[model samples]
Target: MKKRLLILPLLVITVLLAGCIGDGTKNMEQQTELKGVLKLDGSTTVYPIAKTAAEEFMKLHPAVTIDVQQSSTGEGLVKFLAGETDISDATRAPKDNEYAEAQRKGMKLHMTVISNDAVGIIVHTSNPVSDLTTAQLKAIYFDGTITDWSQLTNGTKKGKINIYNTDPKISGTAELFNTKIAGSADKPYVAGTTIIHPTPKMIPTIKDDPDGLAYTPVNWINNEVKMVKVNGVAPTQKTILDTSYLLSRKMYMITDGAPKGLNREFISYILSGDGQSIVQKEGFIPVT
Candidate 1:
């Protein structure tokens, strides 16, 4: 009787082990092994989110390699037009010229809205200017005036305003500036100490220096800097989604053509609930 009981226990153990092995094998086989390298490039505004998505997607599909590169929006469009990348992370939709170029090359762009983010005007925490009128912001950055903090208040006892911005040649944020501030392509930047580069660079410099001011996506704003209110309205998720914020934009994922493989899957994942969770945690607003 004892021997029979022992044999029965051994049989149960063997069955359990077999079930585990079968599940493991099935999981391995069910995984769509993405092998070829996928390339993405575009707006620095969209770069961090794209890079994060690529990293997470690659972990599930170990055979896939996603390469994310930073280029300003216009340059990204150029590369996409040249067929250098499979994906383009853009803060703005492709322009008419870009669409014409893609059509000429027999490539169609597949656009997926990733998130809604406000473009925040940031200043060093030390700056007392917590709110700025849109006219003041335009005068400071686009009209080439408002060179000093004192100038912002019409000769108050404030220090000089150190202005920084992303290069208009490469950034969609700059394009926004051109539209909202300059109202013309040939309009010059508001006069101040210009620190022009990518958005990544602009945000950091503004944070580290107490006298500096710059603009970037709200997701990028942290305790390191303070977001200045525009026309008495603050840049926040509530303001952006409600269309109350003046400095806001939509982020997008652009594919060279109809997406396939991990690229398609990854975008789908971002649009899914799981993906939007990451977006919110990362300080960006989910498209949904």
Candidate 2:
């Protein structure tokens, strides 16, 4: 009877191992057969997060290739509408003009929420200005009221404020900045301000300048720059998730309608719990 019990236990173990091997083999087959290069671009803000995800996805499915680029939100939309890419990552939804343009071109778009982004104004660490009200921000950047750091704070330096911002026409970061800080569409570049392109460029510029104020997606704010408090409220994950941060922006994956193949599968993963964890880890709010 003991020998018979031993044989039964051995059979159970063998069957369990076989099941495990079968599942792994199935996954391998799926990976090997998965094909197609997913071309994606847009929102320099979403670039790092999406690029990281693409790199991770490639590890599991080596047969598939993904290309992520930063061409700003408007350029991405144009590319998506032209069917030049399979995915367009953006910080905002399609504007009325963009939607009309897509319709005119006979393009259909489907949106997938990937994450939430806090549009934050970062200043050089050397600047003493810590907090700003919405009205003050508007006056400084648009109306040219507060021209120097000393006007806003009792800092040692009394130099003119240098503003660095994303491309006004192509970036959602610019759109938010225009709406919240400029309070109008006709904002002239403040004197001593520079408009940076590709959005990511602001990271290094802000780090190098001593009197610069720039706005970007919070995830892109490297340790080199210090985030400023708006109306005495700092930009935090809690504030962003709760919609307390007035400058926060929603991020999305703009596709040429419902996607298929690995593109669809990967997007599904992004909306999954595991994928969202990656977003949170990268300092952005997860859509899940």
Candidate 3:
């Protein structure tokens, strides 16, 4: 009877110990399994890098979900200030008013520079003009002084310039072009410039029209259009990195504040060597 009693106690202890061990193992698994949703929005110009990074990140952490949206930089800032997104991709830093609004909402904005790219002056592939001086660019885009292709010093063609402007209200590309190349926002595009949205849209329209001229992120440059040299400097990776390219700008990922938890992890991944490699692969100059 004493043996039976001792055996019963041992068996109870064994079962209880087994249950505890199993629970510990399960808890460990739960802790290691990254399971959550991460939201990212903004900057169609930065969308390629963001999308590539998000895809690679989700592969390593299949349980985690990442949602990336290609709203313009302005819209992304709006969403970030409104608390609609976890991160905002931007082609430029937030404006003063944007920072003021975030302060009013008691949110601290943190900006991370991820990559560098230039606003390329693109013309149809057949256009003979290969390089433009800054003065000529300002004249063409800002002062409406050069409206015909023949007006260029090297020009051999005689068509009226078909200018395409990115939507200044939303596109950072347009805003940067206006600020850097055109000299100021007040100078404005010559009256009749066609306004395009999403940057890439300018590609097809310009490709179809031989006389078209537009500015877009260098990554979007393809054989369909010829990227003109600005002030005798091409928007190559070397020039962009060296700051010799006149229109170079830093791309960013903005958070409400210093990121925490999964947000921190994801941003770390983006700044990692692998992430920077992806940025280069996508034709943008990696910040690292």
Candidate 4:
């Protein structure tokens, strides 16, 4: 008698789709026959969140595939408009000319707000500064006018401020600061001879230098560094969600027009409870 080898078939399951955007598949844990590849690119900041969403989504719908890539937000929109990708991960909202360009191609863009990121203007715990206006922020980070803490007009922690900034080339928070406060990263901060480094040591630097000032993700701000307000609004979840925080920006996933099929399902998963949890895990403020 010959020995027989038995091979089990790979995947066999019923499809159970969830209700509404952000519901995901919690209602039904079974696998789906859903198949096809989804391509997404842009915004390194949003890359992690999007990638995680793709990974978890594919787990449930094993037949489906999702590809996520990272680039500048502007570049991502360009690719999205060119039909190179199914979705674009963006750290900022769709720009006016981008919308126009999409219209020129006879396609209207649809935006889905996935998360919010805010750059907290941090200072030493000893610093008495409380808030900074947007214009004052430009003067400090862009124009480099207010070199000393005494010029802040908020309170008295008078000293020569040791300005520290993260390089925009590698720091998403820096890039965001450039666009939101500095107006242009290309012509940023000519006002002072400041120390420039990456984000890892920002808190330590500020901790050591009593008169230090810098910016980092709102979440990074803790007992070590005091997070000051922008335009009298503190960088908090409520302020970020309300757009009251000046340095706050929304992260988005865009489609050529309305998202459908895989595009729709993928984004919906991200907006769902499971997906929003991923957003929080990635250091982003969840929108829902």
Residue-wise lDDT of candidate 3 within 1-288, one digit each (tens)?
A: 999999999999999999999999999998988879988899998999999899999999999999999989999999989988999999988888899999999999999888888899999999999998888888888788899999984467989999898776678888888888767644577788898888988889889999999988889889888898988898887888888988999999999889888888888998999999999999888888
List TM-scores for all candidates, in order: 0.82, 0.83, 0.90, 0.68
Task: Record all residue pairs in model 3 with backbone atoms less than 3 Å apart, i.e. clashing.
Answer: none
Q: What is the C-alpha lDDT of each candidate?
A: 0.79, 0.82, 0.88, 0.77
Please identify which of the two predictions, 2 or 3, would achieve the higher TM-score against the true structure.
Answer: 3
Error of 3 at 39 (Å): 1.6
Model 3 whole-model lDDT (C-alpha atoms): 0.88
Least accurate 10 contiguous residues by lDDT in model 3: 181-190
Ranking by TM-score: 3, 2, 1, 4
Number of the top-ranking candidate, with TM-score as the measure: 3
After superposition, the stretches of candidate 4 with alpha carbons farther than 4 Å from their true spots are 1-32, 124-130, 150-212, 219-226
Give the residue spans of candidate 1 off by over 4 A: 1-34, 154-156, 191-193
In angstroms, what RMSD does candidate 1 have relative to the true structure? 5.5
How are the candidates ranked when ordered by lDDT, highest leading? 3, 2, 1, 4
Which residue ranges in model 3 land beyond 4 Å of their true spot? 1-26, 153-155
